[model samples]
Target: MNKDVLTFGVEEEFFVVDRDGHLSPAGDAVVDAADEEEGELQQELTRSQAESATGICTARDEAERQLTALRTDLAEAAARRGCRLLPSGSAPLAETVLPAITPNPRYERMSEHFGATARTSHTCGCHVHIAVPDRETGIRVIDHVRPFLPALLTVTANSAICDGYDTGYASWRYQQWNRWPSAGAPPLFGSLDHYESIVDAWLRAGAILDRAMVYWDVRLSEKQPTVEFRLGDVAATVGDAVLYGVLIRGLVGTILASEARPPKLSNEVLRAQIWRASREGLSGRCPHFRTGDLAPASEVLDDVVTFAAGALAETGDLDFVRDGCARLAAEGGGADRQRARFEKRRAAEDVVDLLAVRPARD
Candidate 1:
């Protein structure tokens, strides 16, 4: 992989909702109807969610175009099926019934094995895949990027409300997602062998059904030659999604170019930091993963931008990242926006309406 200009891709999961913002079982229909020329849409684990994967992207503008086009096409297809595309992490309104599992054999097996964990697993997330030449490099990148995962999650936190009530968390989806035994931040690995050993243990212990169930927030992709960062919620807009992809690419590039050892945060501290980030998002303080000092979330975000400065400059993404940070500062992150909308009417549906990504009409 080129350290300066590594190729990356983004996959975003979205909720399929009706006009009233209720979860709809039209995900398969939407995926089937969406135009695949821009990006690929696939069925998620649940019938209420659809996932879109962008083709390999080398430039910021290319990624933005593909993501925007995919969302637009998905929105149009959902409209034809009498549904809307909700880009939030979790369904704001309480489900009258449990979400239906997608009609795939793997999904069926998951439901059979995990029961409630599978039935209630309807959260959406944004995954960024940065190309790596080999698994060793990918493992190194994951290790180096571990400390910053909380900050990245904070910026993209969008699940403030769930089950028609305030969960008092910027990312309720994260809380729900961590119920899976295999989910959450991955352990720092000494080498590729160390990473595989942990996976081997999980398999032997029956903690995960397969390698694909290695649901760590960061991992080497089983199907792609990339380090996948699965830390953030599905962004609330195409711009937010693009910003996340570029930041991950820059961070991976920065890690690949440097030989410095990243901070070794303990598992307890790492879990605490992730919890704090999910609770506060960008509106409150974040614990510095290196020092455990509390700092404003915005300050931590600026620190991340500074940390990736060299790679961002080399890739000509400095301006875009700067502009995105400024926009988030002015308008707030996804969680903040969701809260603001909910406050207007004190209604969960209002939050859903605010997050619905609709297509332009003629």
Candidate 2:
């Protein structure tokens, strides 16, 4: 990422599960290429997975190379230690009962702080970050891009089935996430001061245990100058990750260059849409916040791509976005495939059995 080039890097989370779908702790021993001799790949807030962060990557090839390398290292480490790394949103029903945090001070603090809610099962998500020029632009980009959040959520939809049941949601992770107090959509900020005013107010009010509670579906990354969208359930496949990354580039640039203001979706309305999408996936009906049109998830997503073509081209990803989306159209969404796989075998075990970590091919 550089000041001169508009660029992005990707971060992803996976559920480390045993063959039986039981949650497997990454522990302190899971090795990573970047780790010191004594340390390891960083454990997530939940110890069910270990995260390997890629070095800042500018072009698509470099991002793909580094991500593949990191995932390969992690897969080898997890296998050597007797567990499997699976990219997914929530813990499958078969593994939902296991609960224990790995040994760490920060995890202990989180357990003490979040209490009952912190024990929830795994759900992976991809976080795509473009390097921002400054905090002001970061906030500005997020604010300007809020209208497109639901569409981003739709295109990346992959969790229509959960446990042994059809949760009847497109992305069940959204349903699971909405339970957290600080989660859901962000507030529409008239200015950066208004956004800071709220954060400062929360600190002054002692509302959050720390700044991490700003769990709005999308936010400015606290440690870096970038707008981060937490809306996607980590894609179940690498292709889905690339698709999401492509959409983020198009949507961010589209908003930056357009006259459109972020849609002012009320908390109630926003939650309703999130719940609807989670339950129905692309087949479910959801509101178009910009036009108030209620349509199926598939229809709304098409509109998102069709509307952003100019911006997509301007960002130099027009063909990439078109080809990627066409691929989705031909394949059916991830949810559709998972659900179909279950129907074919008449079992959730079959679907979970298909969940796995993909290696970079030789």
Candidate 3:
């Protein structure tokens, strides 16, 4: 196997809603109904949600095909239970009773340790796993991608409301997930040993019960030879998810080729950048990691494209990535579309309805 191969996959979480489009705690039933060959459809932290992960793929088109099929399978499964699968990041309305946690020992420990953080945390996210041959390369790629996460969040933002009201933030899921003790931007790791040492310390300190709880926005995957990006909200459409996956691959490829030294910035700075992104999405400015200047989100995203040009060309994804981004910008991403629906109809459910349905291609 080529050590530099950028094989990747996407794991998406979705909420199960009833016929009326309200949250339903029927994930287990839906999962049972799903076809086994559609890849891993696992129980999430909440009974209201289920997650599907595609098999490792090398081509953007292959990933898209797998994701579209998996989503269709999930939708069919949910329909069997008389529920709709909603692809947004957070529930539009608050549940009177928090959804039940998956019946697993780890989740039970999380509930006991984290209390409300675990109970009220029903938000979903899209995690991208890109293979790295070794931990050293994984650490390097993670450091390079840290500054770009906020912009990526802007492109993928989908959580436009919470508790039946506008949250005013594009991706409210980020705010919810940030409350986790080990969540948000990770501090730079000098090497794999440094990363493992910190993980060990967190476990020993009771900050997290296990390696799985190291929920940084980006982290070295404990179960695979990959660096996982857990930043973006679960994209509301298959197109957006594919775009994110390609962009991530491009970024990693760029970093590996350049071999640039990681920028030295405080975690405080990165967290603030992430907060700004969660608040503003693409309509606002983004902080430059090295220059200490705020740039328009579009410009920042363009820089990402420029940085990834070589990789995109090598993978024959340049045109696909460029066109997809243009379409996303024209369609205003998921959050923008959600807000537009809400403004037009003055109903939060309308936003959910738009997200639940398959999106028309641009």
Candidate 4:
């Protein structure tokens, strides 16, 4: 395989809601009902959620097709069970009762150990996996990709509403997710050994249960030769998910081919940038990683696209990415679109209704 052209996949999480837009514990039923030839649908941390993952794909169209099929399958299955699949970062309305944890031994252990963090957590996210040759290259890509994560989060923020009220943040899921001790932005590592050393310390200190529990925004995949970006909320549409996946692949390809050193950013500033991205999405200013100066979010996004131009062009995804960015700019990020729907009807359920419909193929 060419190092500059990589295979990629996307995983998206969705909430199962009843026709009334209330959280439903139909995750297992939905997974069983959905067709899985295109992609896999599985039970998530909460019984109210289901997660879908595409198979390895070499191009943007391939990934998009799989994601669209998976979403359609999940939606149809949910409808059959009198529930709807809501693709959003956070639940727009509060559940009358706490969501039940999925009945799995690992999940049960997580709930027992993490307590409320595990129990009250029902947020959804989009994770992109890009293949690398080995662990060292994955680590290098993870380090280089660190500076762009906040911008990626901004573009993909979809969790504006939560618990029956406007959370005043684009991706409320980002906030909810960071409550995990091991979650959030990872440190820049000097080498693969350095990365493993930190993981060793965290495991020994009981910060994480195992290698799979390394919940950083970006990390090396434990089960694959890929770097997984756990940065953004589950996108609102199939187009949005494809846009994210292509951008990530482009960024990784660019990073792999370039000999440029990663930037040295302070942990404090990086966290603040992430907080801003989650809070504002594309509606407000984003801190430029190079200068630590705030700029319009759109400008920050442009910077990322410009940086990945060569790779995107090589993969024939440049046009797709450009068009997607334009749409996001005009219509706003997922969170912005959700709030628009809510403002029209002043009902949280309206947001659910808006998200439940799958977008038609272009």
TM-score of each: 0.97, 0.88, 0.95, 0.97
Tens-digit lDDT track for model 4 on 1-362? 34447898999999999989899999888998887788778899989999999999998888988988888888888888888889999999877799999999999999999999999878999999999999999888988888888889987899998888888999999999999998999898869999999999999998888899999999999988899999899999889999999998999999999999988876677898899889998878888757778898878888889889999999999888989888888889899999988888778988998898552321
Between prediction 3 and prediction 4, which has the larger TM-score?
4
Candidate 2, residues 1-362: lDDT per residue as tens digits? 22444677778777776666567765335543233321125677676776655556555556666666666666666676676677667665455454577677867776777777666735677778776777777777777766667767766677766766777667888877766666777877767788788888876765556776777887778877677788887776666777787678767766666766566666566666666666666555656746656786666777777777776666566677777767766676667667777778667666666766643331
Q: Stretches of candidate 3 above 4 Å error?
A: 1-4, 357-362
Could you give candidate 3's per-residue lDDT for residues 155-254 as a string of tens digits? 7888988778789998999999988888989887878788889888889989898888889999989898999999899998999999999899988888
Tens digit per residue, CA lDDT, model 1, 1-362: 23547999999999999999999999988999988687788999988999999999989898999998888889999999999999989899998899889999999998998999989978999999999999998888888888888888887899998888888999888998999988998888879999999999999998888999999999989999999888799999889889989988888888898989967877778888999999999888888756778898888888889989889988889889988987887789999999998888889999988888878661
Task: Write down the lDDT of every candidate, Cα atoms only.
Answer: 0.89, 0.68, 0.84, 0.89
Worst 10 residues of 4 by lDDT: 353-362
Q: What lDDT is reached at residue 295 by model 4?
A: 91
Positional deviation of 314 in candidate 3, in angstroms? 0.5
Off by over 4 Å in 4: 1-4, 358-362
- RMSD in angstroms, candidate 2? 3.2
- Candidate of highest TM-score: 1
Q: Candidate 3 overall Cα lDDT vs. reference?
A: 0.84
